[model samples]
Target chain A: MPGVENCLQEAMAIPGAIGASIVDYTTGFPVATTGAAPNEDHEAAAAGTADVVQAAQSRSLFVSAVPHDLLEDLIITTAGGYHLLRLVRTDFDSRLVLYVWLDRLRGNLAVARRRMQTLADELTTR
Target chain B: MPPAVAPSRLLKQAADDGRTGALLVGGAPGGTVYLVRGAVTYAESAAAPGVGELLTVSGRLAARTWEAALEAGAGRGAVGHLLYEQGHLTQGELELCVLGATYDAAYFALGRPDAPAEFRDDVRHWLGDVVRIDPGALTRESRRRTKLVEDIFPQPGLDTAPVIPVTRAPRERVSMTAAQWELLVHADGQRTPADLAQLLGRAGYATVLELRRMAALGLIEAPPPATPDNPDFVRLPRAHGEAVNRVRPAVPAASEAPTVPIVPSGASPPAPAPAAVAVVPAQVTVASAPEAPARPPKLARRKPGARLPKEIAAEPPEPHPGADEVLLKRIRTALRALR
Candidate 1:
């Protein structure tokens, strides 16, 4: 029931959330963003997130051996933050990436990942 | 001011003025930029696929469903909300589609410098405002995309030219994105990126960008440059002869293969006559393609002769263009053998 705006607001409510964005990976366009970008530039952060997701999804090396398997989530832990990207699969080709930056000390990775999965599901399934 | 400012600057000025309406740009295949308050909400161009085409052509929504939404919500300027409310598409999907379409259209609509922008008051897009983009972000992204295309492959004409996949795979292995695969499967060397964008329900800019990247990867064939003097001299690929040589060794002309297709020196055209060449004879090419790997030594020995044909073909056409009749007839004979 949550629209894109409310979804981003909900993402910002997550524990230790620094920023959250929804990006179309194909064009590297940021659809919506809330909170601070890594370099104070949401465009760069979104483009970077897309590049990482695209590289992981397309390359055969990162692809799982299991048939019909897909990349679920990617985590990059920095000195003080955790950048999590969860792929959102729609009815058509999967093109959306949900990116969240969390403060390492204050945020729990396990909880954020679970919440992101639920959010992605809700966003797709209506 | 000074004739007119650039389109992006005009959009910025509109945003700075806190205007809400449509900025109707004028030019070839120009489009309208929608703004609410100060942010760009949506954009549409004749050159890029719109939201309706994105949804229906992608098979995500039926044509009837989109038409129903248009009928019901267009008057209220709430087609997006109506689609979501009717359970045709999810809110996230709607937003993503709109955002993708807007960026795609805006790249073409606002990228043109010759166009003049005219702002009309109270002309909201019927899809409703699903997402708001800052003018600065949109302009920066457009500029970045343009630069990225150049950095990947600097051919400006490839955007409008029919996408021609190379007759021969450049190497034993190459990598591409799923989008590229989709474009390749549909590329008939007749459809430009704009045409494919509507047909495939993909963003026009994304299609062009992928095709450009494919060109950089040597997977795509650049169109032969059309010089006025020798317009009849289509820069035919030398690879077709090589293709025939490998496939039909029984060709009596196999020895003469090196003599046919008199391509000008330095004009090593990459794309053959797309459909005219009958290059998709999968049964023929597939069977012989593997022979190259097994008989590497034989091909290596013939590598020196490959250089001879170009030199021989180049000088002959200059003196008497009619001399290419023999070459044309050989290519025709090869084509007949291919069929």
Candidate 2:
């Protein structure tokens, strides 16, 4: 089965992609690296994005009305680029996030989001 | 000068030599790092709770079962195997528990500056190693875990201090995970995180991670002191009591109504109009919970001597965008104008 490296390769193949990484959210380090790391260290980026993921997730837990909402995907649109973070569930306790940075002008956000989801499902250890 | 030897190299040498033994690392406060033919099969450390403890303390595996394993282990070992075969735990669970515990122990054992490593050849653990990990990989993974905790939640003693749940309700309602709910019940502002970890039989790291998340949500406060002189004194009462008094339309503390007028101080945003506006009792989800009748809107009870603001601070409370309170205020002003 395709693993961390395979996941990163498929992610880098996305159109307009700059760099793709599979980061262990707990450590904020990319488990496997391909091409160049992001503008900032991918590990640091993972750490920052993890804060966002955890904060967003806290919302679903802090209310009784809403059912448990897992953060499936996130897209950040910046002036320079599009950043996508996908939460990849695993059989183990360790959490992983698949991140791809794409050129905003050239990349399609919808397509990127869909592709990342599929990669995450495949990357998950069954 | 000769070059220094790497930890991984020592492990490689052991495998190359076909060594079958426990590489005893440290004593008392330290742990043992085990190697079987150059592979890291098992590890033990004083820094973490044991795999046996982690499983049994969780109340999943009883003491008698562990005792049985030990008794059977004397002549023919693999206590873990015996327990699993007896259906005390599944194969997957046994492996995960041992793996997690071993990794946790190795993290502390390898990083110990005070405890020096000592090797003893031709030795084995009673339960034995569950899986073999590469020495280099183990070092890298352990370091990554330590750094991750330091980088993300750097508050010193965040894990060592007692957890006190926030008393004042910041939001109208709160939610928690199943794990969080169990931890919250045991918080009690007494047991430190590690103590709670052992009590719950959860990994020490996992417990701390949840506590950090809880801190982010303002559900719990990381105590300023390791041993607070007066534990309850740490934010004993909510400081927002004054704000609650100003904003609440009619939050009745006791049965008797307050004499203050409906006009609220400008500093405070208006509280949600009484539950009468919307029947929001406690936001509890369980149908089995005894249903409480919706409480009327809580009114602000001013201090006995506090006087009302002369101008009645007329601008909408902080201009909350598209709020029902804003709409309600505009309607109230229009009615008064008609007068």
Candidate 3:
């Protein structure tokens, strides 16, 4: 598994990737980050998007679901770009989520999602 | 700039000068704020949870593992550094953990401008400096957190007051966040937010935020004010706002009940079944508080050999109930340490 920095490097290597961060949405903390801001407050975005992640994973939302699988990834499409959030499954703390901002014009969302899933699987915490 | 010389400005000044060591801020629960060349590395308040606590709370590291890590990092600057080096936590995780812990501490530790500021040069926290927080930003964040709390509860005094759950609900079927549930469960009407944080080994801010949310919803009420001559009022000095009533119990009348001299103060936690006395952890400790009227002692019924139910028996002999509770809590901490 690629290390944390290596994973960020890999994500940035993807075409049109501009920013990446590992945030513990539960605590509203951005554990790690790479890149420039997109004219918005990174803290606000980091804190606000947490609710989206929480709302999606809430048990109430899953009450009538056919699939028992927890959320794998979340994608937000803006007018200029896409904000892809890939939730990392961990034994240590379940709060960590990987967030990447991609340029919609140049980045391929499907490819970024697949790569993030692989990274999440390989990621391990002692 | 605010007229009073704030700790944040002092921190900013220190950062500009590129100084290193720990700044011991003054307050009731004053604390140390660690800086590495002006950037805030870590901070701790007597009232807030530290990173070490956060690590131990979730059972993240086993005892042996923690001991091994502790041993390996012996004489090193910070155990958090060892944690990162050993791959126990990624640098990202480590920084984030420290940031969360430090901010929580700074919120309480730095707010008092009047509190004396003592800078200890060259002192380093056991966790070392994983993240370097901009002093200006840190101040902004701390202020923001304070504002957030005010927005929710608009009262700072409750942070130290015991939580008393509302006897009657304002509305039916109240929904709450998970953190709120934990805070309410541990509220025990005697322990304040800081006490609950220490007991639960959770962040003080987490407890504060959850408690304030409850206050906004009217799920809980402010603790009854301490009596003017209350000894604990003088003993437990609050640095923030009003003096805290450390001796305030969920059932104030129960403590005032006739003392049964036969029971030992060190008695184990009373059996949970006693409906007569509510020792149910902090929040709901006194369902009978309103119903139980204070009665003058009828000395005729009590003999030296009378057997009392474990409920009232657990705390009857101790004249200083607060001190006894502290002792019992210490014992519980010791037992947990052994485990």
- Best DockQ among the predictions, by candidate number: 1
Clashing pairs in 1: none
Task: Single out the weakest 10-residue window by summed lDDT for candidate 3 chain B.
Answer: B238-247
DockQ of 3: 0.16
Whose lDDT is higher: candidate 1's or candidate 2's? 1
Candidate 1 segments exceeding 4 Å error: A92-94, B1-4, B26-29, B224-339
lDDT string for model 2 (B1-339, tens) is 123343334545676676766544442224566777777777765446666667555655665566566567523447677766676665545554566666666655554333345456866766755566666666666666666566655553565567788777467877776667878889888877766776676656666667776776778875665232222222322433444433333233222123123326532323443432233222222221333223222233333443332224222122111234223433533453355
The candidate that wins on lDDT is 1
Q: Indicate which candidate wins on TM-score.
A: 1
Off by over 4 Å in 3: A1-7, A24-32, A54-72, A88-96, A118-126, B1-4, B71-74, B224-335
**For candidate 2 chain B, which ten residues in a row score worst on lDDT?**
B313-322
Model 2: how far is B88 from its true place, Å? 18
What would the per-residue lDDT of candidate 1 be over residues B81-189, giving only the tens digit for each residue?
8998889888878877787788878887777676666777677877788888888888877787777788889886687667899989888998777789999999998
- How well is each residue in A1-126 modelled by candidate 2, as lDDT tens digits? 354556788888898788887665544545555766556576567667667666665544433445764668878889988988898764334455778989888888888889988887765433
lDDT of 1 by residue, A19-79 (tens): 9999888767787888999989898898899899878888656765666778989999988
RMSD of 2: 24.9
Q: State every prediction's TM-score relative to the real structure.
A: 0.71, 0.47, 0.68
